[model samples]
Target: MRPETGMSATGFPALVLFDLDGTLLDSAPDFVATIDVLRAQRGEAPIAADQLRPHVSRGARAMLAAAFPRLDQAAREALVPPFLAIYREQLARHGAPFEGVEALLAAIEGSGSRWGIVTNKPEALARALLPLLGWQARCAVLVGGDTLALRKPDPLPLLHAAQALGVAPGDCAYVGDDERDIIAARAAGMPSVVALWGYRPEHDDPATWQGDALVASAHALIDPAAWPRPR
Candidate 1:
């Protein structure tokens, strides 16, 4: 193994798992476009990207809540199918890796360490996005919200990913932009990193998340030295 490159001796914990939407990709644009599609039908102007940026990590339901505040819970719930349909069509149109993410990923791979995605996004959507992101062959494992009965904040998904990768939970590190990510990682007995440059808004303070480490930008992780070490 490449000790200088930081490859694990057992090739377990060989992966760095990440959250898809906010942690790796800048998906707020797609969410904004999707919301604008809904708003336009009612002759409403497009919502600002920032207006929906912070809600991206929470998935469709949260997007619906932010996009249609005037509508009550039931009305918002009813809009999910249509919202997902539009989002699927506009999936990667306005989304791309966050600045420096590509290089960061490359660095990880080049170091003989692999990476994967475990997201709250549906399995199909996450699977579809891999090809678009040119990561289909490179991603070591993918566990989506629907991959198992439970997702983040539950720890099942994270634990399941480690098992699939043949890595002990404590040997893996999870990076995410949501509190659920940290909670899940902590529960799974893995290290965690908070992506500060992700969809966090003024109200969402990542400080309290208590991840193993926190980064102000994806660029900060281009060097493996900046990555959080497994406990």
Candidate 2:
């Protein structure tokens, strides 16, 4: 079903910021594949993709920890470079936007709202992947983890994105699949939505995150009613 479109009660958001991995994009497949490649090179059995999918959003270190639990912190850290190298070589090989994302983006644009991405992925990787997804020119602002001195859960990236869009934090909504996403949004004074469809650890509880709203799928987010509004 097509979402109802028009300015909301508080007016359309000046901007909508999204988390890339897990949120807007299903990138776990490529990440898991990269981990499996590493394991194969060591003559080790490949870890199940399902087992490593949840850690994809948490970044490479988390995936390495899951794939090689026996590895110490230093060992896991050492693997990051090679892991990312392999990941970069096959970044979008299996990555695709979640279902209904294109329609959701259309709805936002139809309302004259601008959208952008705010991700913890490295800037270069994020930039590289955007065009492959045909989103390079469409994104209003792109803020990666390394875009500033700090990343999510610190509010810098979100705030910076709002600033770049020339919108007040309160005039934007940030949607993400991780607790850090909500924390950063709340800290930046923006309404936040928890994307339940994104990568989430089995132990992680979205209920406890205190996000303004929760959406089960990209389709749900296309609805203006699903968006969090300033209180």
Candidate 3:
């Protein structure tokens, strides 16, 4: 394989896996706009993007809950459709790859290494977003929350992504912003990195997630040394 570029391969891992919503794509802007549109339609005060940003990485349900904290389960479910519609319409408008993501992906791919995504987003919506972000052709594979019978923190989705990419779970590394992401990677026997750049509620801490590594920025991920080589 080609030597890993963009950074010194002091301890490069075999395969690199990614989280979509927060780690790869900065999706909060689009999500916030959708919330504003929905709230305005309902004659309610619009929520700010920063208020909803952290939950965007958590998935649509979380964003909906954040936007309508007083709503019951039934009302929350009802709001999903409209929120999704507006989100789709503005999907590419403000959302984009996080800083250095394109370069990181390119460097990884150019190094003769393979990378893919494992996200809690639904397959249809995630698939739609990828193309808009120009990642549809770059990522080797994408495992959405609905891709299998279960999602993150269950290990199954990560395992499925590794299997589909012809790599062992132990050979892959997962990078994300939440505890569930680290938990799933650990359960699947895959190494993980906690992405500090992604959205996290004020009460959360990436250090507490207990990932193999903690990345301070998106650019750091391109450094092969960030991933300890397998023994």
Q: Count the backbone clashes (under 3 Å) in each candidate.
A: 0, 0, 0
Model 1 spans with C-alpha error above 4 angstroms: 1-13
Per residue, candidate 2 scores C-alpha lDDT tens digits across 1-231 of: 222233345355668999999999999889878998999988999788889998888998899999999989999899999998999988789978999999988888877888999999999999999889998888999999998999998999998988876777887899999999999999999999999999989999999999999889999877777887753
Task: Give the per-residue lDDT digits (tens) of candidate 3, residues 4-43.
Answer: 3222243445567888888888888888888999889889
Model-by-model lDDT, in order?
A: 0.85, 0.88, 0.81
Error of 3 at 62 (Å): 1.4
lDDT by residue (tens digit), candidate 1, 154-201: 899988887876777776789999999999999998889999988866
* Model 2 ranges off by over 4 Å: 1-11
RMSD of each candidate relative to the true structure = 3.2, 4.3, 3.4
Name the better of 2 and 3 by lDDT.
2
Residue-level error in angstroms, candidate 2, position 84: 0.8
Candidate 3 ranges with C-alpha deviation above 4 Å: 1-11
**Model 2 TM-score on a 0 to 1 scale:** 0.94
**Which candidate number maximizes TM-score?**
2
Pick the winner on TM-score between candidates 1 and 2.
2
